[model samples]
Target: MTHSSVPAPSPDQESLFAAAAADYARYRPGVPEAAVRLLADVLRGRPDPVLLDLGTGTGQVPLALRHAVPGLAHIEAVDVSRQMLDRARDALAPVLGRCTLTLVHAAADEYRPPAPQPGEVVRQPDLITCCRSYHWMPGPAVLAMADRVAAPGAAVAIMGDGSLWSHDSEWTRALRELIQAYLGSERRAGTHATYTEPRRSYQEDLATSAFTDVSEYRYPVARTWTPAAVVGYLRSTSFAHPDLFQERHEAFEAEARQLLDTYTRDALQEEAVFTVLLARRPGTAS
Candidate 1:
């Protein structure tokens, strides 16, 4: 089913995750291992390669890739939410000593590559990764910014599967309906943002951008979730964030638990096909 493009959350709307940062860190799934391997291959022979990760929520992508690519020299992780960045910092602590890490609190499109310091040489980033959160960015502008800052052979990987609320599974269907019943039938995102099905696909956006060479890799993975985990994950999402319920938060949870329990008894597994859309400049090797 076609849904609206997830709009970039405005200043006020960006506050949606402010209170849910902790839940976000604890519940959001890790980047697929296959995706990390693909990224590692891109930086394989490059010396002291730097990675620029946009919308680095909880720093999950970097955390997952640290062991996969021990030679990675640095990472610039940018996000607009201070709360999310805080949890990301904590989550990324293990790898801080292994690689230079810079956490920038700025919108994806507003952040620029860091300037070089005296006697210190800074090379363009070798790889860029945006997972799950690219929908929150201004697509064309961010792509343009990436093209301007990337190294000669650099590639951009935009990765995501639809959120649980939008998945087509039976349980997810009921969960989405429950949320709609509470927050109105329209899907809610960020604070005031509502999802509008995009007229153009992300592939189309990249095809017209400076990075016109693009390919997609899909990994079909089955995941199991408990009732509590499902509810916790919901709290981390923009559409079903707890604040939307306000005074009814506790009451809503009680009902949601009852609803989820019915499905978790025998099976709580769903097949989520994670897709990584890799885009590179015209002359870059894929």
Candidate 2:
């Protein structure tokens, strides 16, 4: 990553993540280790691969990959929220001595790693990951940027899964309705922004970008959530962020707890399916 040129995100977009950083760092589930292995395969020939993780909220990608991928020599993690970066720094502290870590407090679009210093040798990143945070980025523009900063065989992975509010299970359906009763039917995100579904999928976006070899993988996961855990998870998300409830925050939590308890008494856990979308330069060994 180079520091010379990068685009900035709108203030509204930047502030949307302001309040939830702590919750996000505390409660957002990690990317599965299996996913890290796939990422490692994409960078097979690079002896000391560099990683550039965009929208790297709480540094989850590196934290998950550090132990799984042995040759990762450096990681440049970027995020919009300073608070999120703060938490990420704390989480990454133990690994600092082993890996060259750079934490950038800028929106995904506006971040660029500094040029290598004198006596330093730097290569374009072998893997660029934007997990669960690609939706916040400027789609094709970010891909174009990746094409510039990535190595010839490097891969760019854009990943996420539908959240609790979007799950279709009976209990989840009821949970959605409960959330809507308080926050209305439209999905809200980051402060005042409402989610507007992208017109194209990440596959389509990558197909048209410079990194044209696109592939996707899905992982089915089962999660057991205590009522307290569920509440904490909701606080981490943009749609059900705590501030949305305003004066009704406590009431909403109480009702949400009761609703989850009633559902769990019959079925002990919730299950979800997660997907990972990987795009690479043509001819890369995947």
Candidate 3:
């Protein structure tokens, strides 16, 4: 397709991850506990703190932090994809515990909590988090929106680790080469644009936002994946979505399985570093 003719990401993103929601829910790793603890540390004393998790794919972050935050009474898990929200709803329903969950279908900038009627209270989110999905959003705009709706001294935490496609290893290298042969050398981003690194870093973006004070924490994560899990994970990625493979998907899977077999007996190794940036408005308490 010509550059001018190429589609930009749609506002709703309703169909972006539609085809691979099942695999996404299954293969995407959960947010780590130490990250949750650091996020929770920011809201340690807030009574009945409300959490607003942005791009909350399958409700993983909020689910991980359900009881981590002090009296985390209500959670607003927002996503643009209907399929992911549905999966999140299903995954969170049973173990809600003391927290009430509200699944919102919205782009980050479009999300606003319910307006309080006369004599009612509209409690703003104490912590706003976007994990592994913030780059997909309009960063400045989303942070501006958060400034409008969040409580005084509220924190915004953005978290992510590089994906398997981005990791460097013999198996991942072979896998990337295989995908490049089928697709292209450039990375595919969520159905529309080719992958380009964000011009400004997250810290730089936050530096300009209302949340000026930023602290970054990195946690070491070691993982081993079965070849089947690797295949399933590939299906869920924007770079290697099943739609990109078309009729050759099964054939590719067979080749990927066969290729992974030579890399090791069964498991593929991953050593990743997950990072979280916890930010707040200037003068917000620690």
Candidate 4:
């Protein structure tokens, strides 16, 4: 709530999200409450914990945690997309309580929080989070940055719940096929590229970093989406973003809504496993 340093994001074209930021702000789901409680539990024992969130699209994680974590001194939310950062700042400002919030417009690996203000207690981030965004970064460099700046024994938590595009359900399958018919067989990424599966797992990447010890947590997540919300969610995604559909986005959305209506009278459901990989230095305990 107090400070900012100004600059998605992909591994390229940070402005790719500029056009869709409004949709993203309106339609993108916040992290499940379970994730919030889990993190609150993680920091409950620390004297005063600070959190750094990388690739913080719309600042959902930080915004959710703003009032939950006890003695949480500060939050640094870093993202490459200016528009997403704008949405984040707006969303977080109203709810931010005792904790200091910093919105940084920069890449994860390149960002550093400001020096503590005069009369502010010294602080270093004790928890670093990358929610639904680790895959879009230079994993090694970002991990290295976390190692350099995070407090000793600090934890790095990486969170992801699979996208609707990958869910296995009648409506989702139909939607995928519909997207392929318009955009082609491969999933789109950013502006002019396709999404490629990661060659190595996140665990493997963490094992090689300074925060080498890792543990995983899974929370069952169920979401219901209205046809209109689905269309808005698609607009916020890189794969189904309006830009990817060329001139056909409006037509595609119309068809998608109709297709969704055929599947359900009101809502489409998705069951997902929200996975958190909590990493720490050797012998460190959360």
lDDT string for model 4 (1-286, tens) is: 5335533134365756778789988898888888888887778788768889998888888877776874787788888887888888898777766777788777887877676679976667889999988988889988998998988879999999979889999899999999999988999986778999888889988988998888899999888988999998999998998878779888999999999999786569988999999899998885
The better candidate by TM-score, 1 or 2, is 1
In candidate 4, the residue pairs with backbone N, CA or C atoms under 3 Å apart (3 or more residues apart, or in different chains) clash, namely: 1-101, 7-105
lDDT of 2 by residue, 208-278 (tens): 99888878899887877777888898998888988888999899999999998987776636677678888
lDDT of 1: 0.82
TM-score of 3: 0.93
Query: Tens digit of lDDT per residue, candidate 1, span 42-143?
Result: 999998988889888888888877778888888888877777777777877766666877777777887776666788787688998899878878889899
The local distance difference test score of each candidate is 0.82, 0.80, 0.84, 0.84
Number of backbone collisions per candidate = 6, 0, 0, 2
Tens digit per residue, CA lDDT, model 3, 176-280: 999989888999876666888888899889999999988889999999988899999998888998888889889999999999989776568999999999998
Once model 4 is optimally superposed onto the true structure by TM-score, how far is the C-alpha of residue 43 displaced, in angstroms?
1.1
Q: Which ranges of candidate 2 are over 4 A from the true structure?
A: 1-9
Whole-structure CA lDDT of model 4: 0.84
- TM-score result, candidate 4: 0.93
Which model, 1 or 3, shows the larger TM-score?
A: 1
Error of 3 at 204 (Å): 1.0
- Least well predicted 10-residue stretch by lDDT in candidate 1: 1-10
Model 3, which residues run further than 4 Å from truth?
Answer: 1-12, 117-119
